[model samples]
Target: MKPLSSTLAPGNGGAAGQTGLETNNAGRDMKIIATGLLVLMAIVYFTSKSYEEVHPALGFVRAFAEAAMVGGLADWFAVTALFRHPMGIPIPHTAIIPRNKDRIGNTLANFLKSNFLITRIVAQRMHGVDLAGGVGRFLKSPSGGEGRLKMGASRLIGDIIASLDQDRLGSMFKGAVKSQARDLDLATPLGQILEVVMKENRHGPLIDSTIKWAYRTLDANEYVIRAIVFDRANTVMRWTGLDDRLANEVVDGLYKLLADMASDPEHPVRTKSEEALAQLAVELKTDPALRERIEQWKLEMIENPAIADWIDGIWENGRNALLKASRDPDAAMAGHFGDALMQLGSSLQKDPILNRQLNRFARRAVAGVVASYGDNIVKLVSETIHGWDAQTITDRVENAVGRDLQYIRVNGTLVGGLVGVSLHTLGYWI
Candidate 1:
């Protein structure tokens, strides 16, 4: 038998390359050993046949050698037929792998789709996997040293954003914001917020601030008030100096009234202000006319060019900020992202209910993806294998199992020799 050459091409390196080279060498070596045994058997068979008349022992030796050669030749032919036709002849049932490569690819793809990629099986397998915990740990610590995973993720985000059309993205964002804003019930929420503020008496500080502002304004313009009072006075009052006293009285009275409102929480003006605010809040909540007006106002605001421009500005600023954060090495966005991930992970770890829910969600998500795209994935696998040339298919298959097949030849030769010797002994006795 001719020794089969190595299937692996030259200059192949790395673990995969080394593995292929090793297997190829092993198969080649075994093929040589098996062929050498066959040659030795052939030499013995011819020599023993020539000397068979000289000695009875030669008869048994000739029988064993003859049988061994036959067995080795049969096994070698069988093994070679798997990858290629024996002696390069286009024999029937030969080169089985190459002939059925496409079929094999389809069979493999269908088997994977039916058994492995099924939604139930995938979900079951994922059910036990703590994907969230794994993600959390990865986010919390630098994976494979020096935070490369985090940096890689940040760069990926940056690349995705960079690849996007900023103007289009901004437009979409603005549209979405307007859409949501249009759907919002502004009056009810405002009313609820106002109710909460009043319940907590948070408006007290605001009222006090308003009072103080008014007092300051009146004090600053006292001279103006006095001049106005003097101008409005009659001629007799001005000549008698009564106008000056009246102006001072008017200014003092105004200051006292403001002071009273500030010092007394239950003052008439304060009470009236609270009542007015309370009434407005109630009207916002329960008055249909008021609510309708608010809704109309909201619609108008949403439709306004100024609001559209604001939304555009917001989207631009946000998109630019995100892009900058993603690109900047010194930016804390990545660190913040990592920290948020870590916090979420820690929470998932600590909270059993949350962990279980998240795991269920993850499983469902994965199962959904599999259900949706499993056929496409299977088709991809089949098409990829089918695309390969017959020679490529033959080489890969032979490289994988050729060594084991060569062992069969060696075993066949020895087993055939023993059977031949036993048969010779039985025939002689008979």
Candidate 2:
């Protein structure tokens, strides 16, 4: 992962480019100064040599200028040879950086891998870093203006979702659901749920609902019941209206039974229903045959086209809803997501244990990445450098340290001039 600073700032690359440009300009200016000093020394040397016969002091001046010129030229040659051949001459051991660019790249890569990319070294360096706290602070109150972080994060999420293949995503989601369902032990969970219901007497409401439904059905179909009674009745009984009287009695009796079941919680029918449910729950859990049947049913359901279609529909609806929510600026989901992030950040900040765990996890994750991909990273660096042209490598190296090297030329010229004057004095004294 890129550093947070680089990730957050889009202009970092431009800034780095500008910095390199500035460094190159400084190096170029220093090179001109160093070369101009050598030219000045040469002019002085010739002028002082002509006046040496007129004044004895001119000999010392001539010696200083000549020595300064030689020292400056030597230093310039050394500096020039590093990046390219001196005066474009193909001198041995010249153009050192360009000729050995590949070796330098490999050496640099190895140095980085050995010193920085090792898991142990990385872990040690990251030991004091409060990654979790830093993240928490960033999320809670970002560096940029208010709501900028949240908005950017939301936009990123929206883009990612928009770019995905919805059909493929839906298919993958459906497949995952099917796989989970296929592996799930439906019988055991069902039994556990049923047991909880029974323990809490939650099945009472179900019984009451059943009774009410039965009562409504019987009331609405009274005529149907009466007609059935008439079809079974004798012709004499129907003609005398006795069958109608009997149907009314039967309907009234059924209504009274249902009423009793509804009014009485401990009614025999209710008790019997509860007992049956409890027994089924136990059979679901403990009975091997029943469990096997449930497993087979679960497999069938997983294989059913209707179930697959239902899963696909679920994925489609969910994906569309998420997409719409992500796109909408004033969406409740977006607000909720932001709020959740803030809450998590607050929790991480206040909760030491959670913060520590998160930090440990982050460290381990980073260390694992370094251990796994360190070699690949080194190889990439080496290959990238090796692939660059010789001139490109030379310019980069020169820009980085060329100004300092120019200073070396200036120092050598001054130092050599002082030494020459000292030597002339010593020889005259002898």
Candidate 3:
């Protein structure tokens, strides 16, 4: 914002033009009337002096006119001296405003600093204001403030996205993701998750699913299993004992064994499998060698060219989608932002603790700003005043108060004349 002094400067054009014109006209009219009165007095003084001996009343009139002229001229000189030298001649104590511009500026600045910029005054005013509450109420108003906020947000986001360098953003996104992945160790966290799953008995579903999958595989590949068993029997004993019936019986026994394992949770095979899985979970958590191997595998996956390309693709695709959404008016990205802001405002209003904290934060921020920069405002006022042209300052000030000053000239003439008449009457009586 421009300084207050700048706003009052002469060249800063504004609505003051018509008002200034009226003041100027009034000052000019007053000056003319005062000058006319002095001219009338001068005429009476000269005419009455010639007839004073012939008319006693004319002698008193002459005295009044002389005093009136003197008073009017003196007042005119005094008023003119404030803005400029009387009759354009150099005179001491004249052109007061122009000559003392710097001092006047300093005085004005000091006045403002002492009266308006006091920290206690500012803090007291701030304390009386509920800035956070006011904002919350405005957001929650039914006067379409929320709709305007949404539209404003949409335009702001659109402008920002339009100005962005998409390629640069994508590159930065990929680099950050890769850097974070490289610095992270996944094995220990994964092992801890597995430990939690086993401890919580969440692994039962997984074991049951595994058994069902194995049974389906065995049923589907029965012919292959039987063929393999028959081939094994031939290789071991070709001439004497093994035959088709025995192979069939062996395949039937294998199927029955899998059925038993799937149906009975207490079977030896099931018990052994659970024990082995439990041990593996324990080893993953406590064994350093196992962890090291897992870490090596993780590193290989992260560093692989295919994985890097996939990560880059994810960034590029996401960026493109966001950019497209930002440009589309119907995308609702800005609407979502507005809704989130409204929700936040509602929360702040409903939550007393949050509202209090927000107000406190605002107070501290305002106090910090005032404490740090309040002096600058005073300096700015002084500088702006100093920068104004002397004549411009005179014209503006005279225009503002010149009408009132002219009345002083009028009163001086009338009072001086009245005193002269009273003195003449007293002298005659004596």
lDDT of 1 by residue, 253-293 (tens): 98898899889989998999998888888999999999999
Per-residue lDDT of candidate 2, residues 1-430 (tens digit): 2344453442344445678778878988988898888899899999999989999899898889888988888888888899899989999999999999999999999999989999998999788999989778755654336455566565556667766777788778988998888889999999999989999989888888999999999989999999999999998998999999999999999999999999988889888999999999999999999999999999998888998888888988887777676555445334667678778888889999999999999999999999999999999999989999999888777778989999999998888788878888888999
Q: For model 2, name the residue pairs that clash.
A: none
Residue 354 shift from truth in candidate 2, angstroms? 2.3
Root mean square deviation (Cα) for candidate 3:
11.5
* Top model number, TM-score: 2
Structure candidate 3, residue pairs in collision: none
Supply every candidate's count of residue pairs whose N, Cα or C atoms clash at under 3 angstroms: 0, 0, 0
For each candidate in turn, the TM-score is 0.60, 0.66, 0.47
RMSD of every candidate to native, in Å, equals 8.8, 6.4, 11.5
Runs of candidate 1 with Cα error greater than 4 angstroms are: 1-14, 47-55, 58-61, 136-351, 428-430
lDDT per model vs. reference? 0.85, 0.85, 0.78
Off by over 4 Å in 2: 1-13, 58-61, 143-334, 425-430
Model 3 C-alpha lDDT versus the unseen true structure: 0.78
